[model samples]
Target: MTDKQSKAREYVLADLVDATNEVDDAMNLLTEARYPVPAALTAHLQAAREQLAAALTIAKQGDAYRPRCAHQCPNHAHTCDRTPTHLSDHRDQQQKGTHTCSWPNEPDHITIRISGGSDDLVEVEGCEGADEFNCWGIGLTGWRGDLIGGTDTETLRIYAIYNGIWTFAATASDESLPMPDWPIRITDHPDVGHSALVEIDAPAGTRLTNVTALGGDR
Candidate 1:
């Protein structure tokens, strides 16, 4: 993986953590508010919880194979940069392979386009802003991006034209992917003149793959 990709992954992991926290907060708020849990709200809460759990699981797996630097160099030492070659040595000694994803030690943005539709193509905009210092909370607010924010006016939008849609519980590559426990909500913005196209039907054989960066310094 390039530096940009690594940074984007790190930013996504941090956002996952934030999403987990946000879901917890939302659940607590719902309970404290004494609002009767509507079926839809309850379902949404549950789905968010599960997504957060899955994200953490994936993150832990990535962390398990991630390489770490042991030797500390002087502040002025060029070797302290931790290049892929240096990390490769560490990974080899640790019995870890060299296929790990790590790069992009800076803040930037990226877009994920979902294509291969028979009729129309769907494009989702996602941010990938991460600093080189490992600071948290940069881009991709949640696993679904900024698609859940609530406002009097809609900000996010999605629509699907496919006959069938496939939803994966965890990873899309899994054979026995569990069905989505909650409905996927898509919204549109009239003031900003923006829209999002999302697939919701499960039996449509929808396949989700490929994530790309939009545009940035990286």
Candidate 2:
């Protein structure tokens, strides 16, 4: 399993155990009470019981909730000892040069390339129709893609790439704008390609060797 998944499972289990203990304590308090049970206390006990039941349902799913690791290390016998090799190593190799791209309307397609000084070249492209109007931007810190409409509204699925890996990607849309002068309208579809480029931190002593175009859904 991935480290993030493992950590999430651990947190859920810990929360379940604590909820169970609270339920048990509430039950004991009810049984040993010398006075009539207060309405508020009774309501709290009921709530705790319900929460415990819900947590138990999730715990029973077992492997369905926690799957095995999809990728395995090939060089287990190597001298290198890294906890998370894939993510850690990839980030370490991306700090040598600047990765830049231009976002604008294209008649045929838009191509983005990452130059990895003497290393492999990474390129990504998106196509536009013959008559269809296309305008989009690259989101350095989040997911890349334009919404359905050309409105300046930010949506979820935008993620920030940190330490050479994608992280902190989330989306939120609502009826009212949370803050005034927030460039993106809450109701309009988000046009997110012109935002600031995000910088990622690289581990010390690691040099970027190559960048290959990642082909797939962002």
Candidate 3:
């Protein structure tokens, strides 16, 4: 590679390494607390640390070479300053290893247009099964540049059957959309549960290339 290209690659690599290492150190500090730490905080720390690690891996594998992203980025075509996450192999083999559902072997084949889900939405069948779809969550592609995942980080309210069809709300970090692509169980979220249907009201003209669902817990 030319000197300029080499410098660019080094810069990208440094960014990746710094991000991953910072998370690792923070997690260590939190976990090595002198006093008791809240389980919730600890859990969040670990997840962040893992995400950074994964991003580092992808960068090492040359994600910088991907098509130039329209958004601001130091490297050519790279989207997020940090590694954009996807379902990991372990996660795929065992949807967080917390629960299971009749999840498709892959994302939905047919493109689904989310015009508020009344008529133009897709559903994961067999979710009616008790205990199935425990960490019920849905996501689509193109929420991020070309990535098939959620929009900016967000929290969402969903209807699920705990005893009867009930409403549950969940949140994700970092500008994540209400319904992030990550697996999130809909119970004991920061909301009141009431008998209602899962509501999906995305902005107008939002088209989803594919839909994915699986069982997991927050």
Number of the predicted model whose TM-score against the real structure is largest: 1
Clashing pairs in 2: 93-208, 122-211, 122-213, 137-193, 141-159, 141-160, 142-159, 143-159, 153-190, 156-171
Ordered by TM-score, highest first, the candidates read 1, 3, 2
Locate the minimum summed-lDDT window of 10 residues in model 2: 180-189
The digit string of per-residue lDDT tens for model 1 on 1-218 reads: 34643554465566567767877887788888865778777676776576456656655444322333443221111124445556653422222334332322223212223221221223332323211111112222222222222221212222121112211112332324432321222222222232222222121122232221111111
Residue 100 in model 1: lDDT: 33
- Please give the range of 10 consecutive residues that has the lowest summed lDDT in model 3: 138-147
Q: What is the lDDT of residue 42 in candidate 2?
A: 76
Deviation from native of the Cα of residue 51 in model 2, angstroms: 2.1
Q: After superposition, how far is residue 45 of candidate 3 from its true place, in Å?
A: 1.8
Considering every candidate listed, which one attains the maximal lDDT?
1
lDDT of 3 by residue, 79-175 (tens): 1332335322121122232223333334332222111121112223211111212233221100111112333333332221121222222223233
Q: Quote each prediction's TM-score.
A: 0.35, 0.29, 0.31
> How do the candidates rank by lDDT, highest first?
1, 3, 2
The alpha-carbon deviation from the true structure for residue 76 of candidate 3, after best TM-score superposition, in angstroms, is 21
